[model samples]
Target: MQIKANNPDEYIAQIPEDRIPYFKKLRQTILDNIPKGFEEQMSYGMIGYVVPKSLYPDGYHCDTNLPLPFTNIASQKNFIALYHSGIYASPEILDWFVAEYPKHCKRKLDMGKSCIRFKKAEEIPFDLIAELMQKLTVKNWIKIYEQTIKK
Candidate 1:
């Protein structure tokens, strides 16, 4: 199915009927936890919750318009993915997450310099993830973003 949702509502409406619930839950988790600066948009054909350019101009790898230190929630053919850049950028937080949610880390996390990919929505520990998300406040995120921009 071609999901071409323009706005947040439309984007969500395009989600496969069967996966709507999962997507909604994930979306709510991100919405409830992140700060006000974050923007939700369609990115890479998936619902991406980003910390807009004004907040992190050099997103991930200098993509000014893209948001960094954010999460990308995508609905795939068989499962959902909750991609967290913080997992890669901050080892301390990642380690804490792993230690706290061992069951979710049974499989090796597919990570980059700034992303953690989960195959299923159930794999994500919402409460802990929420806590971790909160840790990346605007103040702290800006400091980290600035440091990364320098390099």
Candidate 2:
């Protein structure tokens, strides 16, 4: 995706006007549910929730200046995409998401590794996503991230 904005608001503004409402709803849920120390910013041309540099001075291994990415939300051309490192890194979480999504939402779960692609806002299982978000904290996420890197 193109890096169209440097900040969250700018990123949201760049979203197709028709998609703004869905993005806003998802963004707010993310902000409200994410564990503390995760900073909301524009990354990979989307709204990203990341572990701040203050919490992880080493930053992301791929880009030390950039904070470690936790999750991201983007309004793609055809759908809304949610990228979550926790779900990708943990098989248990991934399984839980896959299983619980259908139980909670009527739409079929459309996902790949860490990315959940929803063609429409209603297709998103917001409650399930919130539950997943609440499952990990900055400390827990860093530990998991490091473990993945070591392997």
Off by over 4 Å in 2: 1-3
Please estimate how well model 1 matches the true structure, expressed as its whole-model Cα lDDT.
0.67
Q: Which run of 10 residues does model 1 get worst, by summed lDDT?
A: 109-118
Scored by lDDT, model 2 comes in at 0.85
Q: Give lDDT tens digits, candidate 2, residues 20-99.
A: 88888888888889988899887767788999998999989888889999999987878889999999898888888887
Off by over 4 Å in 1: 1-3, 56-61, 67-69, 103-123
lDDT of 2 at 26: 85
> Could you tell me every candidate's TM-score relative to the true structure?
0.75, 0.93
lDDT digits (tens) for residues 21-94 of candidate 1: 76788788888998778788877676777767776666656555556646677765655666766665667877
Candidate 2's error at 40, in angstroms? 0.6
Clashing pairs in 1: none
